[model samples]
Target: MNSTTINLPTPLELMIDLSDDQFFDLCHKNRDFQFERTASGILVIMSPTGGETSNRNIELSYQLQAWSRQNNLGKAFDSSGGFKLPNGAVREAWATPIRSPDASWIQSERWESLTQEQREKFLPLCPDFVVELRSASDCAERTGEANRLKTLQDKMKEYQENGAKLGWLIDPKTKQVEVYRSGQEVEILENPTLLSGESILPGFVLYLTVIW
Candidate 1:
């Protein structure tokens, strides 16, 4: 991960140095707030998702979980699961090695390859699949803010750069979805009723009615 500055409008940032253990402990201690870090070790405090967004997130997770169980192709993770990116500098210098996607899935083979200790810590690899939902605070219409949406778009690009096979940036307010695939242009779907997993997931298809 490269060190870059992101000028956030809210939930002020504080630059701090904490080891992985320290950071993990801090997260548990302050369970009420969401936190993220940059590759340069700047700690970001994320606001909680609103009720509507939270509900939609639950549905999204449920669908991914159901499909994962039936297919047994990979493991599904919720918003709480933090992962350590593989392409990064040493943790001592930059503690921004961890990130938590709203929803993610890792192929079974890659998951099985992790040591128990590594798995217990922040997962040391990018997931095969990732999803980013635009909450009320993130929606352009709701807040009249483009930064949040742009931030998410940048995140999707980061995921692709870091080796994620596929990603989805779902914007509920606009009923639009931006599909990200490795080495390809982003495909935007307007008011999509269903999203096909394509070659990445083969037969898996996500119905958007519940989300809408």
Candidate 2:
């Protein structure tokens, strides 16, 4: 048996700028792939997750969704959801970039404020909370893992800078979690069995049994 496939053009890194509409259209044209645009209009192509990584991601998203539905406080989003940032000169006066987290949540009030079109497109606002899970690719080599850890740490900082109240970088390989929050120091939890959502989530507790 053979699987059907489309012959995509050879991937290339071009420096041409793209308007928000053009970028959105580009994303729509290639929905099968993951795309991220940086503040400088540099496009990043992300590979799809492997089976183990996808399984772990689903578990995380499911946990967040259940919690959100029960509390009725926010909306949970999976890896496919993207958010537009407010920095850069990509789109004239409305310069911005796009990013997606492995899992995220936006507060009810903030989410409700968005128009139907905004909700359907890349969210124009940052999520209230975000989570990044480390996959096998992130820890395949000692040097690479160290560099990836730094990048993840930086990403958590970026989330805080962009208005995320809380964030977590969970590394199954090291069995550790790095917590990030606005106006607080980064907290490292080693081999933690559970993670508390603090005042931001108010009664939410993330158990790490399935994650590990």
Candidate 3:
């Protein structure tokens, strides 16, 4: 008797033919596959899927919303707010990327003035604050957790270098958060008290305790 093995196509391979907009829509429709655009091309990242990350993200979103409302910071979002970078035109977060962040925040000025089509096509502007939560599926390989962290770091650097006020990288595994402030060194916080700037969120204090 002879046995045969069948090969399966990866999601990225299946999506190679789609335009950027169509690709984004497809990912949104599926509600899986954390997605993002890189310097190279569009990527459909695969990660261990579960509810823990989602729950944490929801919690973070609520915190941000409360902070925003209390401080009049305009609006905050999770992975939903896509940003336009200097190099590339648009970059949106994936729905369930390997290492999904808990929440992101955008300043009021960025959201209020839209170019009509821009509001419909992409996120109004780059957010003032970004937060990423580590997951069990996060690991280091070609398409593993390590790569995800690197990609996220690069993107955060890009945003900060451009005009973003601050960014946060949360690693639940390590119980630590890496804070990125424009024109300053990346600070690792085990339990930091620093809050977001008035230029960004005014009176909002991003408590790392909530994330850890």
Candidate 4:
């Protein structure tokens, strides 16, 4: 993985950082670069290309948003927000050690409780739901899903512990979703006919046809 270390300055120093236009220009110059903010600092991310997998992930994100709106599930986002952990630590969407999931959800009340800085950072209190879309860039063939799954599973546990209700890991090639609950055993939905869950988004049913 490629990485770089950025020195974080004080809040006042942050004011002297790149202007908004400069930021956008920088981003435009680097297709691999992604920008996100958190309570701690701003983040710039670069990752290997995932080609078709990236497109499929994006499609799923739009579908999820439509489903959320249709079901009145508050709001949904695709790699677009940070997260405020229970410890008051804020994490940027792109700064997460792991790749950002395709989509995430948070209830209205939690959304409203954030501070302006937190809001600007757009950090979720705890996502009521999360979805990770598997990609060819994933080290599935070598490390397999064990390590990745464990990491995601741990994150799901953290979210659930912090009040999140559900999580999903979607593998496009297999057309499957692995559902994770805090205490319950993981459930695998192979070639699911429908994506339905009441805990996270009540009365929502996303058919498989859209995905496959």
In TM-score terms, which candidate is top?
1
Q: Each model's C-alpha lDDT? A: 0.83, 0.82, 0.61, 0.60
Report the lDDT tens digits of candidate 4 across residue range 86-107: 5333243222222244678877
Query: What TM-scores do the predictions have?
Result: 0.87, 0.86, 0.73, 0.66
* Lowest-sum lDDT 10-residue window in model 2: 7-16
The better candidate by TM-score, 2 or 3, is 2
Across 1-212, the per-residue lDDT of candidate 3 in tens digits comes to: 99998553232422244554775586578664555554344455553345776666777788778888887757777766555454433245332111123577666777777676776654634666777666655543544666767765776676676556788777766776777887898988775544454466666666656555
Candidate 2, lDDT over the whole model: 0.82
Deviating ranges (above 4 Å) for candidate 3: 1-18, 47-49, 88-101, 140-148, 191-199
The deviation in Å at residue 134 for candidate 3 is: 1.9
TM-score of 1: 0.87
Q: What is the C-alpha RMSD of each candidate to the true structure, in Å?
A: 6.6, 4.3, 5.8, 8.3
User: For model 1, how big is the CA root-mean-square deviation?
Assistant: 6.6
lDDT of model number 1:
0.83
Model 1 C-alpha lDDT per residue in residues 42-69, reported as the tens digit of each score: 7878867779989999998998899889
